[model samples]
Target: MICYFSGTGNSMWVAQTVSERFRDNRLTDMADAVVSSNNLNFSLTEDERLGFVFPVHSWGIPWIVRKFINRMTIDNYSNQLIYCILTCGDDSGLTNKMLLKLFRRKGWQCRHIYSVQMPNTYVVFPGFDADPAELEQKKTAEAVPTLEKIMAAIVSDSPIDCYLQKGQQFLKSRIIYPLFCRFAMSSKPFRTTDKCIGCGVCVKNCPTHNIRLENGRPVWANNCTQCLSCLHRCPQTAIEYGKESIGKGRYYYGKRKDSQQ
Candidate 1:
């Protein structure tokens, strides 16, 4: 089984590639899974493997991903091989190690954890912008060959270095995440404008279902995943996180679903 959480389709692509290499595969979106409370009805037998793919945030796993892993209940699956793939824009740093600890607490043994560089979608940085055409080209060029190699490695049961093991330990300790939660996550979310077309694309696409239509505009509730799916997909270009995401290009994966019909 492969369970993945993707913010902007980068991690989704990685999850899809990994699943394609295996038989009897099951792919579940972390967003939908969370909405359904992860009631995925699959039994992990001895010969099976469990894989998780997601993006890295704040030099660690996203808060929702961590919650999902902690809340999951798996029993009688000691023989299953576990692997994780983290997609990041830059250095993953300590994220992989934090994941290992979480998995360990859940009684799962991890065989390998790996990281891949995707386009930096976290727009919080100052003056963040990328050429869409070039970004897409680079992403495709890098992903295709890298994913092929990763799939080959998984098939061959190759070994991987616990790259961020120590760093993860330090980050996950008492001080770091708590301070982050209090300060960083507590900041106000982006606001939507009257130009919103009442399309409900943001509502439907929000992984945590945190946005709801009120008076024909999207209102973000506190349970946001901060994935930017809603902000990126707004056709009117009306969504703004902090002071209007000036000069940041929006991205959407696959074909845009025609909501007008």
Candidate 2:
């Protein structure tokens, strides 16, 4: 089984590609249940090969990913060979190390861990987001080969230090990630422009159900994960995080689609 959480098309595309490479592979979206309600637990099939494909958020696993692992309950997980594929924008900081712990706590071990550097998607923060045209093209081009390598590695059950592995920067990732989780996840800053047509695209894409159409407008809740799914996928480009994001590039799979509904 391949379980994944995708904010944009990047992770979803990767997850689908991986599922194609394996037989009897069922692609389970962890967000479907999470978005419907806050229920994080998932029951697993007995003795099936297990795989996870998710985006790296702030150099670590997204908080929802962590919660899913914590709440997950499965029968006979010990016989499953767990493979993890992390699609990261830049460097993944000690994410493998963190996952090792999570798997161990769940009484399962990751047999193969891999990282693929996909296009950057975290566009809410300044400088930490968006890439130039040339650079974006370069990253996406490089990802094709990287994805192939990940497919080969998982199929062969090869466990090696990935090419993109870098220093964990424990202080920043361990300290700052949680701090961001605590303070930066507020949805209060989101604003909808007059361009909003209330097509309900944001509500459909939100992983946390933190967005809702109220009186023909989208309302933001404090439970937002800052995944930017609503903002990045807004068809009318009607969503912004504050005055700072007014002119900021709205990024999805490397380009901005038309804002017209």
Top candidate, metric TM-score: 2
Off by over 4 Å in 1: 38-42, 130-132, 161-179, 254-261
Worst 10 residues of 2 by lDDT: 252-261
Error of 1 at 58 (Å): 1.5
What do the candidate models score in CA lDDT, each in turn?
0.71, 0.77
Give a tens-digit lDDT track for model 2, residues 1-261.
Answer: 888888877788788888877764677777665555566444566666788888888778888777777776675555667888888877887788889999888788777888888777777777665677677778878888888887787777776666465675787579877788788877888999999999999998887777888999999887676778898889899998886576676667734333332
How large is the C-alpha RMSD of every model relative to the true structure?
Answer: 4.0, 2.7
**Model 2 regions more than 4 Å off:** 35-47, 166-168, 254-261
> Which candidate ranks first by lDDT, i.e. highest?
2
Model 1 C-alpha lDDT versus the unseen true structure: 0.71
Per-model TM-score versus the true fold: 0.84, 0.90
Q: Candidate 1 on 92-168: residue-level lDDT in tens?
A: 76776678788777677887788876776776546655336576557656867776766667767895452323344
